[model samples]
Target: MPQSNINRRTVLAGGAAVAGVSVMTAGITSGAAAAPATGLLSGGRTPGAVIPPSDPRYEVLITGINKRFVAHPEHIKMIRSAHDAEDAVRRAFRQGKRVSVRSGGHCVADFTCNPEVEVILDFSEMNAVEYDYRRRAFVVEAGARLYNVYEALYKGWGVTLPGGICHSVGIGGHVAGGGYGLLSRAHGLVVDHLLAVEVVVVDARGRVRTVIATRHEDDPNRDLWWAHTGGGGGNFGLITRYWFRSPGATGSDPGKQLVNPPKRVIAHSFDVPWSKLTEAKFTRIMKNVGSWHEHNSGPESPYRHLSSLFNVNSRAHGRLSLYTQIDADIPDARRLLDDYLAAVMAGVGIKPVATTKPSGELAAMPGFLEPRELPWLAAARMVGAPDPVGANPEARVGLKSAYYKKNFTDHQVATFWKYLSDPTLTGVDSTLVVLSFGGRINSVAEEATSSAQRSSVIKVIFQNIWAFEKDDDRFMRWIRAFYEDTYQHTKGVPAIDDVTDGCYINYPDMDLADPQYNTSGVPWYTLCYKDNYPRLQRVKRRWDPSDFFRHSMSVRPRN
Candidate 1:
């Protein structure tokens, strides 16, 4: 194993970060429900399709989007409702089998597909999106994909949740990890509108049952609800469904309850080729990005309605892409678009090879993938299209992520230029992606929900992907080295500080758990949960005393 890049001087900083985060939280005022209700309620059991090794679907079901890990569980159970999920768990428990749950099958890590897993409760079949009249919120099943959720909410109720741009991400892990996307700049995270969650957990007595936890102050399981707000997946329990009702919304009309995204958006996208850009220009562009977000990424910024994604591709790919979107309904929407481009491209003299926009179609940028045609860029077309990841299942990937509370330091810029332009790792398509984060997102306090990374101006992800299993190690080493050099002074990982506020849970990087890679005494949990770890631990012990729901990074309860 390779030794971590941390020096002796930086190790102590991690301990100090943990010691101080206890005061990093605040309380959110929620409406009162009838009262706290504990349940041993079991729904009618219906046996779903069971696939064993012999079944044809088993091979496909065991394979997730990432080709890195594949499950060899004894069998996979297809689930539909809360009853189905509970039944699968109870059966797995009774048989003393290692259990894992799959939603949308998009987990980049091996949480679900590992050697020890004896059974996988596949929830992709449980997808259901509908408006709950009684609760006055949209009830989305855990297995439901982002595109389906958007289609149902927008077409049926004229509303949408502020979530990731990837159309196939599952509601279960996404919402639980504080999902965000283009609209997050204006509406906040997906969890910001979370009203309640239906979770199937193992009781202290080893009995399986379902609990409905809500943000309602009087609800007994309110802590559970808080934990899921940003606690990460496979931690507390199996989240079967999430109920979304915008906070402080009191109206009866469902259409008026949730956020109303701009019906039309102005999408501008362009690319800068490495062939025409210099290292100095790239560094200047990177610094300007941090400055622009620092000045404009706020709740009251007139540019709040604008969101942008900087797909700074690894130099091996030959080009960097910029995609910006703003509510066309806003006044001076065009000017907002032009000013953003000017600010980011200020000193960089390189311009797009050609500016292209369709005659009658909506122009847009699809993040995490190449730009799509204008027709596919339309909101409806974007949602209906399959995610490029799901569209192809041959690539293996490794990820490292960071949250920036301030602009990029000159040192950080140099690190990026060095890694992205490294000629040694020839032909590797590793990318240092910068997403516009923190607008209305920062409006909430650090501890208001489980998602503690609210103050960051931008989110950065270091991603590398390859086509063959044989090349996994080379690609992983390259990306890891790239990230290590960027935070070389900070114990090999992005430690909590003024410039960097730790990592995002949604982008789980197991390297943080390895002492060899993360010499920072601050443990993976601290880097992710911060001060909120203790509260999440208490909830873990209360709801899952035996720690029945667990994985490599699952919340562990103190005995």
Candidate 2:
């Protein structure tokens, strides 16, 4: 979770695959097959604009953050100015066509890049970041990538904002969904620092108006700002830009807010041959780690400087590896590593052979190697709240998650082994990840932002990766079954209740809405939004009452 400088080449290269669409065929068809024209309203002229599928630049405009999901949209409009954006939305609403907004296009559910859409308001053209030295704030366009924002702020003002780790994730959705990163434990969610937002909201009359809401006490639209914190994308409105509030008294100048990227982030890998790990060791690791997470996540823990993420992979020489980031220098980092390793060793009752390598902050953001070569097809299940972080025997590809109030437990440790033993349940390429949560993240109150899951201790992401597209059904079913089975095991069990939040928005899977998978009738938003769903619904009603920007699991306005 260490911060890294934005590597333009990597980003451009990563984005090139999708951006390299064939211009020759971009607008060869007319009628339904042809792309729609720019939905910009008249009189809102802009310096740079690409309207409709007929434009020669259309092919370059429609590509998204995720190439896997990008397809030919009926229409794509690239807007550079806020006025251009407003005109596009107003035009789309007037035409009675469905409008889908695309920023990074990283949504796994394909909500932003759906092929059936009539129009796409692509924001990739509006990348800009301006700093107000006097106010200690910065204005960032939604199109900027997390890495771009990081580099621009650091190089221009020596400041950083807490955002996602992935260099390709667009700031648009990241901030809207409550951005979390290594810095989150120290600075809180991105919305915690959001001071104001410039949004283009569509009214019931199909008119688009620009609204500016600030975090000031007297700002009447403060609730609107709250809704954007973690409300998820396309719910309230199209956020054209965001103004970040300055961190309080980090230092007199920008250097005070900057942490010299960690000198070395030690990464350790341990390949626990499936046969060598016992149920006891697995359960112990889960429980101990879960317990440790709970214990240190409380209001009093100073462990924010130390964080760890464990990946249990079912394939690629299957291994259980731990990656930890220590905020201290080299010597203290060694001690931190020793202490953490000792805790895990004691809980699992086995000495894991670990290889520790030092890496810079940039390497940590995207990893030393390219993740593009990594498998794209993967499915995951998450268990949250009050559950003992133990593994479940019935889990076919089980992903058990927990928010520790203290440290992990012994029971959870044993469960890890039992869950991974069933080869039929998990293929050779599955992974179980335990990511660090809390720390500085918990310092902020639940009401301070839209991400109400602030009290969570840790997040367990059980994921399975596959090589062939044909195996998609099999792998997904396995993951879903594992999730259901784990839930059953905890049903009516101590400390486990119906309120268990289901999953993260970034890993969207609509199966949670199906009665077969979620018999609890706990709407999808509850898993991602917790108690903040209602407020989000109001925002949805106010902005997109017609439900133009919607997907299977999008926030639904209350009837």
Candidate 3:
């Protein structure tokens, strides 16, 4: 999607009613809850931690990015440092409780906030992005959000990590799941620059210790670091911090060595009113998008710095929007952008309209708006808003995702249009967000990291955003049916086919692991990890032999 700055305030601004806890009927729990208490850990109070279900902040603490699942942990430790995280893990082990860690609280799946969790280690307060001279890398705490990392890295050293656009998405999960954003086309995935990681792991002997793993060969714990590279969170251990530096980057001159942020960026948008959109028009648009990306998304493409998000909203939403951005530093940037758009129109047999063309509520032609130029930081701050249209971040969300090796097939495109054009569906907030993927990101080998889907050209996110509890069933049913039908030819889920590469682990869907929902016969782990599943499982066995860290979709030990 178009890169936008996501910060804490905007992320929590709007959404559905406060979520309720999904308590597992038989999980371990503390006996009869009393008044709020502290000192849940061995040390006195552990600074400012709070044992939950009793503390006033319990509800807020467990409410995460999706708001669909609420955790009811017996204890919520407000961890301020790595020591705090280690201590919390030790406590969970001693108490025989299942532990879950929260950073930006953005897991789409119920992994972080389910009833199975007995202890929650909150890292929200530990957010810090700084240059570590000793390590020769930029150190980002797991709790730090993308916006924070961007701002800090840009202002301090003129470098940044190519991560997700959501500002409030914590680095912990984002990087662990192979973080990507608009810059991914130019810088590759975040894991490509990952140099080292600090994690709190539990051994088979039940001892909790902090381990620093790195990409360096001599490092005995190098495999541990490899697992963190797109292995997904809540698998082997609780990550405390990550260190980033471009591969082969040397010297202390951060500005001269690491990837620099675009000096300036040009942002542009076009609106295609739904009223003017027929099935043919929609098909043409999808075809144009697919064709354009297929041609331009190569490691050496001159348009690598340009990326756009095509948001196909349902008919009830009145309009579909396309947001595009390009590095203004490139020569004749305006002409490049114009030519790119013109080429897209050509692919669909249409003429470009004037930049200032006035658009009606449902214009037959896309109305292009004047492009705006902003400095790197200014653009990031403006673009970083969670929603492209700046919607409230508190909106409850359900998401399903897929990676495309090429473009949509004719059947898939028709299926999309059929469900999206359905007048009977009531969730107007739902949309299909197609993000431009590939470029330098694809240059990496599939086996280099756990994120094995290296050749995808587009990333598709199926989203349902709503605000009412009563509408939950309706929204869920709508999204589920839409997804099922879209992939009906593939056994109710996206398998590794010519058109699909399963789903993104970062956008984890429990349905992929459920036999009731996934009848494709291909295991969810294979869908997400492909050939990397075995290595990840081995890492899990080594770091968490007791299976101390786990979730519904966590990597399991080899049988």
Q: Which candidate is the best by TM-score?
A: 1
The TM-score between candidate 1 and the true structure equals: 0.88
List, residue by residue over 268-308, the lDDT tens digit for candidate 1: 66777788877899998999889999889898787888887
Runs with alpha carbons beyond 4 Å of true place in candidate 2: 1-72, 247-275, 315-317, 329-334, 347-351, 354-419, 424-429, 490-502
Name the lDDT value of residue 59 in candidate 2.
67
Every model: Cα RMSD to truth:
10.6, 11.2, 9.5
Model 1 gets an lDDT of 0.76
Q: Using TM-score as the measure, what is the rank order of every candidate, best first?
A: 1, 3, 2
Error of 1 at 294 (Å): 1.2
lDDT for position 532 in model 3: 92
Can you write out model 2's per-residue Cα lDDT over 12-113, one digit (the tens) per residue?
A: 100001211111111112211112212212222343454667878666545443233454667677656566776777777788777777676556565776
Which wins on lDDT, candidate 2 or candidate 3? Answer: 3
Backbone atom clashes (below 3 Å) for every candidate = 0, 40, 12
Give one digit per residue, the lDDT tens place, for model 3 in 1-559: 1121222112111101111111111111123111121212112223446766877767777767666778877778877666667767887799899888888787877888888888888787767565554446676778887887888788777888888776777888999999998889888999999987878888888888777777877666888888988999988888877878899786768664467979999877776677777788789888888878888899878788988877688887766777778999988888888887776556454433332321111122233367878787776665566342213446577789988888788888998899888998766767898898899999999988888988888999898877767788888888888888888999888779787887899998888888887888999999999989999988888989988888989998764
**How much lDDT does candidate 2 score?**
0.57
